[model samples]
Target: MSEGVTLDRTGGLITLGAADTLWADLMADSAVPTASAALTSFPAHARMGYVLLGDRVVATVKTGSSQWSVLEIEVRQAAAELNAVEMDRQDLVRIGPFRSAAKQEPMEGTALRWRQRITRALQERGGLERAAREDARPYHLAGIDWRRILVEQTRDRTVRTWWLPRAAVRVLDAAEHTETQWLHAARACQASAVVTEPSSHHQQVPALGSRPTTSPDCPTAPLRPYNGELQGHLYSVLSRKPGTSRRVAGWACAVCRTTPATVLDHCHEHGYVRAPVCQSCNTQERPDHLYSNDIRVADHYRRLFDTHAADWLRHWHRCPGCRARTTLPLPHLAAWTAHIACRSLRPTHRDARSSRARKPCGVLRVSWTGSHSAPRSCLLTVAVDFCPSGEHRVLAQVPYREAAEQFRSWLAETAPAVAAAAGPDRLDDLPTRPRPVIADTSSDGLALF
Candidate 1:
């Protein structure tokens, strides 16, 4: 087995210490000179070195019949200049007539002395003449030039000692970058390994006949029905499968889908379960219906009062016996019915009497035509009034049988006038036949004429 020598190929120059004196001397005398000579001969490679204080090199010269030797060359070089002199340690060796002691320590070591001597000889030979021609590029550890160190280490069988450049080493050592590279490599290797695996016999089994395997990670649940309007609540309904029970959870309006329903309406009158109703319908529709129904009843009473007033006015040529006006109230059947019903439901008789007294009576005023004016016509203005006394009174009296006969004839003749007076827009609404009344109570029993 060959013993391997360790080489520091970590880039840049490695400084040597006192223990390395012999090694430094040998390297200085042999390697440094050889390298300098090569660079000088090429004139393309740049070469340089710093001189130390303690090491020396022995050079032999042959004289006639004997060997001659000289000692204490005391040569030192730095900043690429060389000269010989006696010097103490840390001497500024290049550039001056100044003695070493004046600005620097005295120069030491034979090797450093030899280095100075050789450096002078080389400089005198015009070594720096090629400095401008030689490439002055700087070496960066991150760049390609450092790879040469690795190659050298590999060739010397010292690969383990080799390392990438400083910057590259830092990147490789980072936890995040290392983890990313590891994951990428692992995924790639796993995929490749899977590709290399042999196919199994199980793949030949029929897929249709295989027992159904439910994925353990995703369990199936039951479905639910949607009962509310499709708005904000649609998503919650769709998330469930159909035709299955889900938690009722809370109440919501079935129609509008607005929550916290305004009213729970029971269809007790129609015989069904209670259902949620929205505020808009609850607050508006119920009251409106009652109002409309009252209007219908009020209209009937108003028509009766108007008929009596018209007949009494025509018969007596004045207002009625009750001292009521001849004009009739514009019939608001709904309000009249509501007023009456409200009165009927009063808790006490006095309360009912007060309500009735407050009830509105129908009346009208007539502006009749003079004999020279348009034929048999008058302008009728109806107004509603309330009586202080809660008493019902008949304004005109005639035989009931006779009043009925006259009203029928009068209604027939006045139907067209009434229809026309209602509005030209409503002329199309004229009834084809007369609406019949069961009785007329305007004559003897005070029927409304």
Candidate 2:
């Protein structure tokens, strides 16, 4: 009971160690607050969000940060230059020195060593799971972890406390995300494995569903009636015999080429059904995502506009007149050919101009005035506000398919086009110059889409 160590002392100020605080009552003074006011020690804090949680790894990265990456990767011998098991998540490529996207210079191999270190650390903490599971949150704090912040209180009675944060945590039933929007960023590591360099990639995991439980966009829409083709497809999927013939799960994601596409990512503007992108496409390739502008992406959108422009009218969720996502079902598809009124079976109270406008962007305007034949287009510019090297973006219309192999043709043709394209050219190619948000740039061509 006599074990005592004075942590602090003032006019009435006093602090106690954990032992002192526990047995202070046995001492002469029990009324004094025993909570350590001037705290010293701190716990380990994992730098990144991907921390282990009892056989699970919760993790998160900046959304849309992964333009392209491997789904899974493994290193064999921890040599100076080790070959990765899976490269680009498609082909197995050896780890050359990772290049700086801006300088295009080969970087150090220590990057892999760090990855090896962290992989081992994760195993020491716990481990990760690979198979996809349904019940997942954008962020997670697995369980009630036994950790606390040792706070240092200031001299004044006002109780100014300096907290030493050691780790990431979150509260339950709150808006708190544990820096971990998700916890599935770990691969099973070999007990003897070593990393000669640092590494990373987005492995295949459960995607953000059509109506994610939580996202920045609030007030999620409820499930509504879909078009006949989609409904029929769903019906076919539902009606299929268990463990037999081809299923919708066999569909591949057009974007990433992941098999068994889970959801359809359609453009809100045109409502044209684009393609069977891997279900992850719905979560990752969100609408309003500005493509860096490339020929392939432009061609993708153009084909959608050309093939299924009128498909929205077939769905029960369109305004029909304006072709927006509303409960009001428009009776007829907007007339593509000019000089014809929107021939709807029911009265929509819209006029001929609403009916005849070509390539409507779904946004209703007071009056429609533009070249009726051309499809809508926009320019997508990425990177920081200040760009020293040339900033290249393209306005996407159906016609620019021939525009410079890489839209360098259309980039010069028009400054303003619909949102499409990715990456910029390295005309200046000044590696020493300051530019922000550059993934990769080359005088040869861009690699984004």
Candidate 3:
């Protein structure tokens, strides 16, 4: 363990690892000796690097008491300390990186107003400086990587706006690509999982796209760019596999893990073909930049992207979180950042939400007409409120309300009648409702006979 790993209860510097709970730290019995002396000092501080919600600076809260993080702590004290540093977190507006694979322009007009407002608000108390990370080794390109020019204005009293691109990141060697380097990391992940046999794992591998400068392999070379024709490109990539490069096999969205991979998601940073993503993931994952809130998170993302993403199927299905988050759609950097930070305040949030449930105010039986060949059956839900919504909205979020119980019970009672009457709709509404019902002659449900 390094000297910096020491935890002094008196000094009140409580740095909890992703796995470490402050509760455990405080509740631990006094001065009991253990086999592993190092664990008492450094309790697993590092975690897998991930694509975090935002470019966040850790706001360390200090109190004389080590138990300051406990739920029972006085809100006034926690708020006072946290507000001094993190209250302005929401108001901190970002500037620049105004370019893409397409446009390369500095923040101007509407984008220009924010910095001026921040500077104006600062007055004489503080000034701004363009801080550079000593360790950021930018990839050599023909022109300035305009997309990399991201500046986030800090909300502290001094109000510092930093153009910190890849600052303080112990990234891979400049010559090596993330994909090429991920093999080892994948092995580490597999090894940790204690798999007796080798099986691929990629729950959250990034669906990055490719650049001309990026390495063209069996996996990457066939994958089309985001701007290209999707279905046609998918066909080309699938059909045109050479002896050197295996066909890019998986056809599922990288993020959602369920939808047919519609678009080729590229790494915003390296311009490498990361993975295939559905239109939904492509539409929502707005930030071209792959975000990492902490070193561990970033490292995990790199390793995952480099390894699992190369195998599209394993990447999409391995981790359950990636599959689940698709519907909930933690979506992008902004949402994930807010979500993790807000978790600490869940005790308070729970208390605040103890009011009456927002149950269905009223229910409607709006009929939806669709073709017989329509692919979805989740549309015909019994408990629905008037949202002027369609099948997608219902499938996505709108849940069964508390007030829907009575109607649902009645509907359940009527299920036998509904099944009996399912034979033919007497053309009361639709012109095609009276169509003849085909007999299922086969004993098996497949109707092949």
lDDT: worst 10-residue window of model 1: 440-449
Clashes of each: 29, 33, 20
lDDT score at residue 256, model 3, on the 0-100 scale: 50
* Residues 334-440, model 2: lDDT tens digits: 11110011112112233456665433212110111222222222121112111223222111222212221333332223322211222233122322311121211
TM-score of each: 0.13, 0.20, 0.19
User: Which is the leading candidate under lDDT?
Assistant: 3
Residues 1-449 of candidate 3: C-alpha lDDT, one tens digit per residue: 32333445533233333112332232233121111211112111112221110111111232444322111121122223222321211221133222221232343321112223233323333322222222232211111121133344554554444332221110111111222223334455556665577654422222222121121221222223322223212223433446312222224345555343434543221122445554434433332222121111122232223333334323332222222221111112222222222223222212235574333222222122223222121122222234344321221111212212322333234333322322223223322211221221111111000
Report how far residue 321 has shifted in candidate 2, in Å: 15
Say which prediction, candidate 1 or candidate 3, comes out ahead on TM-score: 3
Please provide, for model 1 over 124-212, each residue's C-alpha lDDT reduced to its tens digit, 9 standing for 90 to 100: 44333342246343211101122222211122452111222222222111211222222344455446554457754221211221211
lDDT: the better of candidates 1 and 2: 1
Q: Which lDDT values do the candidates have, in the order given?
A: 0.24, 0.24, 0.26
